[model samples]
Target chain A: MKLAHIQQILQAEVLTGAGSLDREVGMAFSADLISDILVMCKEHTLLLTGMTHIQIVKTAEICDLAAVVFVRGKRPGPEAIALAAQNDIPLLLSSLTMYESAGLLYCAGLPGISRNPDPCGRAKGERTG
Target chain B: MSEQAKPEQILILEFTLKSLDFMRAGEASSEFKQRLKKLGFKPELVRRAAIAAYEAEMNVIIHARKGVMRFEIAPARLLIVVEDEGPGISDIEQAMQEGFTTASAAIRELGFGAGMGLPNIKRCADAMDIQSIPGQGTRLQIIINNE
Candidate 1:
């Protein structure tokens, strides 16, 4: 899905990368934990996170994420916005909850990245029975 | 013509990390990633190396008093060695376990301290080695093959 489409769907404000709205993103991953993103995120996936720190931008850069949408009405400070602009990472802010944002995107034909929660490949609550 | 085989060339990069320096934490690994890209490693290889290196570097920035990250790049592989002066892990085995973290609530607010750093690094690298003294410090080495 194009980022412009995502912005409109969630009613998010583009903090930066206004020029990048036309870029296409195929997958989306929502997480508040940076480590979860680090360990599980696929390259070029769009990131929907509530954390408004600069590390989110750094994680996106390291993982080559498509863009970051801050859910729950979170707003990153100037420094975070500056770094994202410097790194060419688009930052968006939305009033929707993480669940709502993710649901809207999923319903709009954007698929979420899937991963086994455990590295061992066992389902989180699977029973042998 | 020289009969001896040519010695393999290695590129080296060194970086200093300070604890709680959240603003500049990932700069070193970002540079390493860019360098690898400029040298033309495959994107998958570059991403793996960058993720491993960034996690290692963040470990230092999150827990150490100070540390150094050294990168050794060869045609076949990339080796990253991070040495830090901090409260070293008393149990390497436990520290390597996923979801076992010592990070404080403040660190968690920054979206870290999930105890997945070492395990994630291991997942990204082909080989990993760690040595630490409870009070003295810790040293970590990670190698990601170009293949």
Candidate 2:
């Protein structure tokens, strides 16, 4: 799913990277813990979380995520917003709870990151796309 | 700085991991990922290196009082060594297991200390060597072969 689609589906407010709304997201993962996202999320994923800190932006960079969506109507501090802008990561805000946000995306056909091997037998976390 | 004949080398990056610095926990690892990308490493290798470095850096910031993380790059190998001068792990074997973390509730709230740090580092690196002394510190030497 494209980030723009996610924004529309969640009625999310763009907090940063207004220019990157069209970026493609290969997968989706939702977690409030930066480390969980860091360890479990794959590249080009739309990460949904309530963790509003610069480390979230930093985690997106490390994990090669597509963008971050702050769930439960949470908003990041100015420093985090600035960091996201500086790093060119799209940040969004949604009023939906984490469970609701993830459910909507999964119902929309966006898969989450999987630790299981791919159908093609590729190793775990390998990007099939 | 070496008088002896030495092969042409790449960059050596160093970063300090501050203890409980929640605001900037992943700073060094983020920069390390960029460096590997700018060097044109393969995407898989870059991701592995980035994950290793990030996990290792987080380990120090969460577990130690202070630490230094150094990256030594060469044509065929990338070496990352993080040394922390904080309380060391008493059970190295236990620490190497996934989901065996000793992180406080505060750290867990930040989405860390899930006991995945050392295990993930070991998974990402081609080879790893760890040295630790209870009440002293811990050191991790991680190598990922660029070739």
Candidate 3:
């Protein structure tokens, strides 16, 4: 899914890296735990999370995640925003909760971070990194 | 520097990890990540080295009073060593498990302590070793190959 499409679906506000809205968001991993995120997120996958801390950007940079969408309207702090901007990772703010953001993404043809298909029997899309 | 260095020289980057410094928790790893990227290690190797280094750094910051993290980049391998001065692990085996964290509720609030730190580091590293003395401290070493 394109990040622009994600913004449309979640009513997200792009906080940084606005130039890269056309960038393709590969997989989506919804989690608050950084460790689990590191384990599950592939390089360039989108991270949907509630934690709006500098460490999130650090983890995203390390994992090479495409972008981060902050759920529950949790705008990232100044340092976090600066770090993300410096690292060139897109940051988005959304009013939807984590569950809502994840569900909408799933229903909109976005696959989970896992390689396997979703359990709801939704046919998988063109899966590639 | 790469051209002038001796063939057997080990490029060691060192940093001190302060305890519970949430503000700068991931700084060391992020800096090291940039170093690897600048050095042009393959994407996968750079990622694995970064993740393993980050996890070890967090372990020291969260669990120990203070620690030293060393990142060594050789021609064919990457080595990470973190030695902390705090209450060490009683059982290395149990600590290595996937979900056996001892992090406090406060630490958990920051989205850490999923018990995946050590295991995830192990998964990324080509080899690893852990040593600890009760009431003293712990030392963790992990290595990843360039290939």
Candidate 4:
């Protein structure tokens, strides 16, 4: 689904990256834990998060996320907005709760991202650096 | 592509990170992502490299007194080394366990510290090496294959 459609569905206010509303995002994952987002999300996956910090923007940038939707009417500070703007990462504000937002988007044909478990589960790294 | 398919031109970049600096924590990783993209890495590989580097950087900012993130980019692989002068991990095995975090509540408030950082890095990188001296410091090495 295009970001524009998501904006319409959730009635979200676009805080940044209005120019890229046409970008299509097929999957999304919601989490307040930035670690979970980084661990689970795929490239171009939309992120629905309640946290409004610069780290969210940074996470989007590093993970190459499609965009970020701040749930529960949360609005990030100017610093985050500026960073998102600088990175061309769309930041949207939605008044809906995280669950509501996830449900609405999921019902609209946007699937949630599932982890691709490693064939050998829990592959351990070398102890020696 | 194999290592012999291209010449070894290791491009190096370094960035210093400060403790508790949430505002600037991911800058180095973002820059690394852009560099890899400009160097024509696939999006998936670039994202993995950037995410792994970002997690490593965050570990330093959240737990270390100070740290340096160094990147060595070659044609077939990228190596990220994060060295931090901080209270090193007492038990590397416990630290690598998912959902095992010793982060302060303040750091956790910023939507981090769910104990997934190192595990996430391990998942993203082709290989991860970690060495830590209790009460001294930790050195993390992550390598991501790029063809």
Candidate 5:
């Protein structure tokens, strides 16, 4: 889905990267735990979380995520927004609670990327850098 | 491939840990990951490097008075050296135990005080070595295979 559509559906405020609103997102995940995010998120996925911190932006950068949506009107500090800008990761703030935001995205046909059925399964596509 | 003709390139970054400035903590790791990407490191390796380095960075910020990180890169491996003058860990064994943490409530609220930093480091690095003295300092050497 396009980022602009996501913003409209969730009623989110785009804090940065407004020009990238037409970018497409392939999947979504809702969590504040960095470890789980590291293991589960796919490239270009939308991140929904309640935690507002610089590390969240850093994590998004490392994982190459498309954007972040802050739940429950949580305002990420300036440092977080600055880091997001530097990394070219879009940052959005949503007044909706985490469950409602995630449900909205899910109901809109955005599915979470499931890990391979086998814990040791290898990814079946070209490796990315 | 001509091994003798290729020059080794080393990328180094140094960051100061401001004792209680939680907001600026992950800047170094973010820069480090960017460097790794510019070098064409695989995503899996990049993920491992970022997780290990970020965890170590957080440790220094929450537990140490000051810290420095040095990274060396080659076609075959990535070496990360993290040194800190923080109150050294009293027990490496206990510290390596998953879910063991001395992080404050404030750190926990940031989502990392889960006591999984060291273990996560071990899980990500191909070879890991840590040396610490209770009152002196701590040094960690982590080697990650580029394969």
Candidate 6:
């Protein structure tokens, strides 16, 4: 999907890099954890998160992410926006919550980046389950 | 190899990773990327160098008390050396496990700590060498081929 398409679909505001809207996105991952993103995100993946930190932008840069969608109406601070702009990373703000935003994107054929199922079936937060 | 034939520009960055400075953690990596870009590295090589350097910088900040990152850039390759004085890993094998992490909740909240730092360094570097003592510190040497 292109950033323009995503902006239209989610009714998002493009905070920066409006010219790069036509960039291709091959996958999507909705998480705030940088490590999980590093491991799971593919090049050109659209990242959905509520966190408004500079690290998110840095993560996108490192992973070569296509765009970042700030779910739950979250707005990044000026410094964060500047960093995103500096990196040519398209930033979007949406009022939709994480689940709804992810669902909408998934329904539109943007699937989550799948990981190998953990044999232990341990959830994200459980320690030693 | 003649010293005169080697690339002339070498950039070195030294910073103190104050414990728990989440906001400033990835700053060095970002700078490293800029340096690589100025050096006119290939896109693929630049990406690998950025990932390895960024991950290593983050590790020093998240896991160690303090550290320094030195970048040696040449026409053929980039050498990155990161040294951190932290509670060294007792079990290197366990630390290498893909999903294992000792990062705290604060660190995880910032989107790191999925235990991929070391793995990322290994993945992005053409060669990686790690030396750590249980109580001393950890030193990581990574080289990314520029050709």
Point to the candidate with the largest DockQ. Answer: 3
Model 5 docking category:
acceptable
| Candidate 3 error regions (>4 Å) | A116-129, B1-9
Cα deviation of B35, candidate 5, in Å: 1.8
Residue A81 accuracy (lDDT) in model 2: 94
Model 6 docking tier (incorrect/acceptable/medium/high): acceptable
> Of the candidates shown, which would achieve the greatest TM-score relative to the real structure?
3
Please identify model 6 stretches exceeding 4 Å from their true place. A22-26, A109-129, B1-14
RMSD list, candidates in order = 6.9, 5.7, 3.8, 9.3, 7.2, 7.6
Instruction: State how far residue B145 of model 6 sits from its true place (Å).
Output: 2.1
lDDT of 5 at B79: 81
User: Evaluated against the true chain A, what TM-score does chain A of model 5 have?
Assistant: 0.87
- Cα lDDT for residue B82, model 3? 91
Per-residue accuracy of model 3 over A7-29 as CA lDDT, tens digit each: 99999999998998999987788
lDDT values for all models: 0.91, 0.84, 0.87, 0.89, 0.82, 0.81
Query: Considering only the true interface residues, what is the Cα RMSD of candidate 5 after superposition?
Result: 2.1
Superpose all Cα atoms of candidate 2 onto the true structure and report the RMSD in Å to 1 decimal: 5.7
lDDT by residue (tens digit), candidate 1, A49-124:
9899889999999999999999999999998999999988999999999999998887666887873234222354
Tell me how far the alpha carbon of residue A15 in candidate 6 is from the true structure, in angstroms, after superposition.
3.1
**In model 4, what lDDT does residue B90 have?**
97
Question: Comparing 5 and 6 by lDDT, which wins?
Answer: 5
Model 4 interface CAPRI class: medium
**Cα deviation of B22, candidate 2, in Å:** 2.4
RMSD in Å for model 6:
7.6
**For residues B1-147, what per-residue lDDT tens digits would candidate 3 score against the true structure?**
111233575677788889999888888888878888887888888888888898999999899999988888786988888999999999999998999999999888989988999999889999999999989999899989877
Q: Candidates' DockQ values?
A: 0.72, 0.57, 0.73, 0.67, 0.41, 0.46
Ranking of all candidate structures by their DockQ, best first:
3, 1, 4, 2, 6, 5
* Candidate 5 local lDDT, residue A47: 95
Name the weakest run of 10 consecutive residues (lDDT summed) in model 6 chain A. Answer: A115-124
- Tens digits of per-residue lDDT, candidate 5, A29-50, equal 9987775676567778899999
Error of 2 at A10 (Å): 0.3
